[model samples]
Target: MKGLRKITPYVPGEQPNYSDMIKLNTNENPYPPSPKVTEALKNFNPESLKRYSSVDNFELKKALSDKFKLSPEHFLIGNGSDEVLAFCFLAFFNSSDPLLFPEITYGFYKVWADLFHIPFKEIPLKKDFSIDLDDYRQNNGGIILANPNAPTGLFQPLEAIEKLLSENADVIVIVDEAYIDFAGKSAITLLENHPNLIIVRTLSKANSLAGLRVGYAIGNPQYIRIAESIKSSFNPYSVDLLAETLATAAIEDTDYYDKITEKICQTREWFIRELHAVGFDSLPSKTNFVLSTHPKLEISDLYQHLEEQDVFVRYFPTIERLQSYLRISIGTQKEMASVLTIIKDYLSQLR
Candidate 1:
């Protein structure tokens, strides 16, 4: 079992796989995808399945380029951002020096590092859970920072990100903007001059296409080429035909994207305020999920109680800093209201 014994696998949030529960554990959008996505699915021809999926790289790449106003040569699409990230780690982070990343950011980064046998350093986050970029400027192999970092949901301003890119030109720097659609700014603007920079993104979070599994990386042409080469050598058709078409549809329907994101943000703000009004506090979040804890309540009991009520949220009960916290994904307004009611009822019974 050496393969299994190599490292601990990353544990994602629970998926109930049933429709009865109010699931908020995964950072998935509660809104439906653009109508265009549905239309694309309906119009698909079964005959296309016979041929190996031919993702129109020119078209999908052009769509991404037009949206970001970047060159088509600068983009590489993967099955998911996770695969894109894996490609990046393999393509760029091969040095003997330890790769650098925040200790508390996305869990999958560490998983990928271990799986690839890449040496990495887990730089500690500051007391407020903010990444101290200075800790990463040391001599290192490469870097991957998750903006609006996962589970905690705090966004680092674009200025700090720019500084990191500016100071660390020697190492490959990856900004995993999986949640950037919810957060305001993207570091894509920095790609023009920073040849060392790569921005990995996914439509899964904001487009309600978590099931579709499409993610892309944007960077300078040379770096993009390196990743694309690796991808081709491994799997020429990493993305299927239906996925490519639907993903393109989602990308083109920018209006639906904006509207749903606005709704999620609005709901997030209200949920934070309401949680505070009831004595539970949450971190200021730009992502569609909030990491929260009550000062006096036992987090474990609260987590279990909510689960019993058919309400599912994330609980990192074993992590030192996260033991007392529960990460709740933003759902529809009504779903969140139900969560508030349940939490208030649970707290009142304690009172």
Candidate 2:
């Protein structure tokens, strides 16, 4: 318990055990991963299981580089984007200076800063829940932001990100694009010009590889070297053998990724329109989830009501501003229809 007190863990969305529940809390892809990933797993060699996997993840890096049209030297792979981000904090961020992000952005940013004992300052978002670029231009040792911010499901355009990069040439600018495939643009294009820029991505969202725990980053060779050094020092084989194989297959199958992303985006738009018609004000989302607040229902009460009806969605009760809102992951049409029916009945009961 004494050692445990020193560690504050990140709280992921709830994974409830209710069998009938339409689970939509974690923003996981409603569809299965590509058939290639399944084939890779089934065809895995038992002999390779005895040996340590690639310390450099050469094959996975090459696959990623080829997909992004970047050199293998410009990429680095990790167990998850969280590990890649942890490496960034240790390798690039200095304790003497502060890390900056939006106040109401991803909760993990704050957790990581605390875990590493790094100083940080959170710039508050504007009234509309959008990041103000001027706040980032002022000062900092490094900058990290979720492009399509978590919980809020809002995104800052690539042009705005370019402005931040142009303004802060001295500090490292890390863009956590875990949700970028759902969004319109990616900052990977700026890597050649901006040596200090790092783009972190994960297979969890668009690629449907959350269970595999594969994440990667694209940056200048220098920055990639820093992450590699830290990874080698920490855990050279952080990414397992099977994960590397599956992730490589997943990245190579861009057609599957594109198809799923398009479907998710389409479903998301239809869901938003339906929600609005039912009087729930949902933020325009670029990710697979929607953040919304009902005009009449208390979020807590609604959450409990949904749970009672075997429908699970994410609810953050701690953040006062967001307590009235619920973050709903886009599930299948049938699942969402069930949720809507439950909501319609609940609202009718309230009336």
Candidate 3:
């Protein structure tokens, strides 16, 4: 029980398992996977289930290579970005040096650190919840940043990423770009020259493939090999045959992917305007979620009111700095409109 005893597991967002519940919490793309994914599933050979999937996930990695203009040798696929990150923790960090990350980053980083017993320090975000670039320079083991960080959805510019990579040539710099598709730019542009940089990406957001659990890592050939080695040691098959085939089709359906993500972006802008009108303000967000707080009401009350109405959103009452804010994922325009209407009605009641 040595490793088991040192555990603090991650707490996932609440699921809207009911038929009538409005799920605007987990930040999943509020859209369906591409038509291609459906087709791939329909066309899959049931016989393939008898054999293990290609351990290297060659075809999917090759498709990603074409997308990023990198060699298949430069990519590593995983069941999900969470698993990809766990493999990274095992591959790069150690107990001797504490890892460095923002206090309000994707919570999984801390979980992996604890599971691996990799000591880590959380650097506090600025008062405005923006990262302090200078603070990361004092890091010990390595770096992990979620571009357009979770919950807050605030993006760190590539210039900031470049500063970290350029200065920290001696250690690994892991950039979780799970929301980068929504954010417009990616650190993958820096991977060619920065051997220390590792970029983790996923299909859960923009590609609408969350249930299929597809994610990849792009980095120097060396980093890719390390991740693959760890993966092979733990579980060689990255995903089932169905998931692999469907993810390929999903990635290939570029037009559908664009249309869906574009719709979410347009709806998010409109939703933010509505939130501001309701006396709530948000930092500019590039992810599928918006984190906002109204100066007049506590987040707990807002959460309870929403929950009472079967409108599910994410609120982190335990994180000290985030206690006042609620993270609301972008859903269909209709779903968001309902959220706005509910807020407006509730505010009027309070008056």
Candidate 3 lDDT, 136-164, residue by residue in tens: 87858898999978878898888888988
Superposition TM-score, candidate 3 onto the true structure? 0.97
Top candidate on lDDT is: 1
lDDT scores in order? 0.90, 0.88, 0.88
TM-score of each: 0.97, 0.97, 0.97
Q: Using lDDT as the measure, name the better of candidate 1 and candidate 2.
A: 1
In candidate 2, stretches whose alpha carbon ends up further than 4 angstroms from where it belongs are 1-5
Give lDDT: candidate 2, residue 48: 88
As a TM-score, model 2 comes out at 0.97
What would the per-residue lDDT of candidate 2 be over residues 27-136, giving only the tens digit for each residue?
A: 88889999999899899988988999988899999998888888999988998898898988888887477999989977898898998889999999888888888888
Candidate 1 clashing pairs, residues 3+ apart or interchain: none
In terms of lDDT, model 2 sits at 0.88
Taking the tens digit of each residue's C-alpha lDDT, what string does model 1 give over 71-102? 89989999989889999998999999999999
Give the residue spans of candidate 1 off by over 4 A: 1-5
Q: Which stretches of candidate 3 lie over 4 Å from their true place?
A: 1-6
